[model samples]
Target: NKLRVGLLFGGRSGEHEVSISSARAIAQAISSDQNAQKYELLPFYIQKDGYWLAGEIAQQVLTSGTPLQLNGSNIQLPNPSQTSLPIPTSPYLPVSSSSSSAQVADVDVWFPIIHGPNGEDGTVQGLLQLMQIPYVGSGVLGSAMGMDKIAMKMAFAQAGLPQVKYMTINRAQVWSNPCVFPKLCDQIEATLGYPCFVKPANLGSSVGIAKVRSRSELETALDNAASYDRRLIIEAGVVARELECAVLGNDNPKASVVGEITFESDFYDYETKYTAGKAGFLIPAPVPESVSSAIQEMSLQAFASVDAAGLARVDFFYVEATGEVLINEINTLPGFTATSMYPQMWEKSGVPFTELVDQLIQLALERHS
Candidate 1:
């Protein structure tokens, strides 16, 4: 019997489009002749408004490369004054008389391609956990740690991994204390100094990240980052080559060849990252064997530090002049788009995209058992 694989994508996060691209790539690979006889692909798309669309609708989104429009009359705007969180609903359960729980429950395994907040930050992982279904990528703990930059940094620190100096701020503190924002800016200037990066602690895709070189830019960056997530992370900028390594497995994770990211932009921002031709990659980065070995070792350590499983991509900052390799961050659920580094790195390391997805699904089943 063919193994049924539920492919989840398109999310409420800013990386929704990127997730769709990833799902398209994954679906093509899974449906390819190489593995078509072994697996059945079942797609599930989560709408931008957090509604779940399955069956033909989900398949159409993947085929058309467009998201389904939600009915305006059915949309409900949140209460501006409401402070309490809304009770969560299971996307796998039947939503109406026309829907069936078996659509999700009968799946042999799940492959989640959601790249940011609501999907990648452990919410979907927790749901899959509750369902007792085998799913790809990291578990609840790893996903949560990987998504939150502040928590991820703390985990890296606990593991004694070398990383750039950074500080965190809470939106609530900035809004309630009034003096907190200025105090944070003062501390950042005095410590990390000018030319630092401000990022939303829980977001990916560089959605709310900014490089600030002055107090004015710093204030603006903070406000911008705060709009996406409550926690904000400010990191000291460094002049170094950005290198990434892909890690795969559970108890014994293996790191792939190092890949360097070169961009003309000031930094690897959203545009530089997603826009084809804007960024270039040097596979098997021309670093010394020793440097490559060190990066590979650090990548495995970073993966284990976050308790990541199935797959992850660990980024680093390598300073050639100083011979310093600083850990940037680990992405448990890294992008799977055609230009994404994770699959590319693995491909350079002898695993093709189709085989990589096959291995990931196998790993998911292994982990579940």
Candidate 2:
């Protein structure tokens, strides 16, 4: 029998649309003739408002571009003894009245493509662990750490990985105590200086990130970032090349070829990352062999720093003038969309899309076993 794969996407995060695109790309790759014989695809889409969807209706919801209504039946993963498998239920699909027949088909593995917050921040991973199910990407600790910039930076510091100087802010304090704003600005200017980047601690796709060059912009940026997450991080800006590498596997993970991202926009924001033709990429970035090797090594270190598993895309800032490379961040569950860099870097390293997906699934099963 083919390995049953649960493709979970369309999460409750701001990256919901990006997750849909990722699921679409993944589904296309898995459904190809060569891969189709080896696996069965089951899609579980979590509507923006938290409703679960699957089967024919899920496909309709994805294709029709209609607002997902909560009226439909939601999916649930009951205790293992309650059902023979962890498959989600859908009102669109039929179920027999018998207890044995009420069970949905079992899935051998789960591929979570949810990009941010509730999905990638360990909440879903915790659920999967409770259900005793094997899933792709980082486990609870790694997922939680990787999702929070403050925690990730702290881990990187503990691991002795070089990184840009930064500081964190509590949204509640900043918003509630009006007097704290001036002190916060003074602290930021004294530490990171001008041209600092402000971001939500637990978001990706460049959401709620702003590059502020002045005290006024700093306040606005902080407020915007706080709107997305309870914690906010401020980092000193640097003039450097934006580089990324894809790390794969558990225990002994390896890094793929390094890639560079150069964009026409001021910085790699949400629109620049997801929108077509907004950014440009350089595969096997035209850097010295030593720089490339160093990045690949650091990529693995960053992955291990957070104890991440399955796969991650490690980003770095290469200061060409100083020849200094600083680890920026690690995306535990990077994008798998057609234009995403994770798969593209692996492709440049000679791993095709199908093979890359196959390897990730294998790693998930191996980690569970």
Worst 10 residues of 2 by lDDT: 89-98
The lDDT leader among the candidates is: 1
* Backbone clashes in model 2: 0
Each prediction's TM-score versus the true structure: 0.92, 0.89
Q: Model 1: how large is the Cα RMSD against the reference?
A: 5.0
Which residue window of length 10 is worst by lDDT in model 1?
Answer: 77-86
lDDT of 1 by residue, 95-133 (tens): 332332226665789999998887888999998998899
lDDT of 2 by residue, 220-270 (tens): 998888888899999999989999999999999889999999998888898
Off by over 4 Å in 1: 71-102, 176-180
- After TM-score superposition, the amount by which residue 194's alpha carbon in candidate 2 deviates from its true location, in angstroms, is 0.5
Compared with the true structure, model 1 gives a TM-score of 0.92
lDDT of each model, Cα atoms only? Answer: 0.86, 0.83
**Candidate 2 backbone collisions, by pair:** none
* RMSD list, candidates in order: 5.0, 4.7
